[model samples]
Target: MKKTITAALAVFGLVAFAQAEGDVARGEALSVTCSACHGTDGNSADAANPKLAGQNARYTFEQLLAFQTGDRVNAVMSGFAAPLSEQDMWDLAAFYEAQTGTVGEADAELVALGERIYRGGIVESGVAACIACHGPNGNGNAPAGFPRVSGQHAAYTAAQLYAFREGYRAAEPAADARMTDGESMMMRSVAYKMRDFEIEAVAAYIQGLH
Candidate 1:
């Protein structure tokens, strides 16, 4: 029994190591293509494009897969991701996640209001705290596959929230597979409750995250 357990543990360790190695190797190779838009270190200089540095690997991977499979639709991203394999997506995500990110400051009034909205949802408005999943500092959990919102551009964040609220942004098909019916319902409900002003406030708060 002891020997059998030992063998099983050894196999598990080897599998884990192999998977990690694969992700790293693939991520580095796939990153070459991403450097054009995302920058060499994942810090995009383009105002229209969000920086990917310090983003959660799972989030990055999921987005890539979504674009490739038509779960998420963006003309540019769809074309870019279409040719990538699963390993390629994983590798690129790892590469971006390994990079460092920069933070920007928010205006005093905006910050104060943003903080109120982010930490305490508007009860009358039926909004929920952004911290429920994004964590207090906006450093999203790797396991949960949430992207890091801290230090993200306010404009970019606001745009994304707006898209989600309008149902213009669809869940990556891969992500939908993992989500339960309840999860989807909650997301739809929460998104519907967010107005443009609320989106701006939360985004401003997120920009201040360091």
Candidate 2:
């Protein structure tokens, strides 16, 4: 079953991410506006925003496309994505992917619960462990378009989990609802089964995963 899933993912990645590689040098020049929210080096100081440093290029490009197409809606991000051409997006993705990511200290009190949720999902709830897609160190599967979660802000991670869960639970998702997990809706499915506390726990764990 694992092999079958891996094969499927490879095929999907081939079709979905078949694009020219980006120019990191050009990308740096294009990231002036992005530096406002995300730091100049792609690591956001604010916990509300995600740190883009060390993210998978393909994943970042796909997200830019999603925002541009209105498949994923964010008031701030959408506007930024609107004027960007495909090459521009790829360049920005490349630039961010080349930067280093930093980790924050997790709450000692939350580590046990958080680690449990991240390394082993709540069994009764049917939630899959994060390590399935994101590796043990939160590096993520680059070829499969999984973004690196290591060193990501807990607040941002939790917000995204909430977004995924809310989108999944809606009887009919809003046209502009955020849903970037791809056609399989894997993230939505997993997040839907996760309890609120579990989401918080896992997000906290992910923040300090590295």
Task: Supply candidate 1's per-residue lDDT for 89.
Answer: 70
TM-score of each: 0.79, 0.89
What's the number of clashes in each of the models? 3, 0
Model 1, 24-142: lDDT tens per residue? 55566677877887787888777467889988766776677667756566778889998987667767777777779888777566788789887887788797877887888888865
Q: Taking the tens digit of each residue's C-alpha lDDT, what string does model 2 give over 1-210?
A: 000111122223223545446888888989988998999999999999899999988788888887787777787988999999988887888888888999998877787899988888889988888898899999998877787999899999998988888878564434434466766889898888888888888888888899
Candidate 2, TM-score vs. the true structure?
A: 0.89
| Candidate 1 ranges beyond 4 A from true positions | 1-22, 168-187
Candidate 1 accuracy as lDDT? 0.67
Candidate 2 shows a clash count of 0
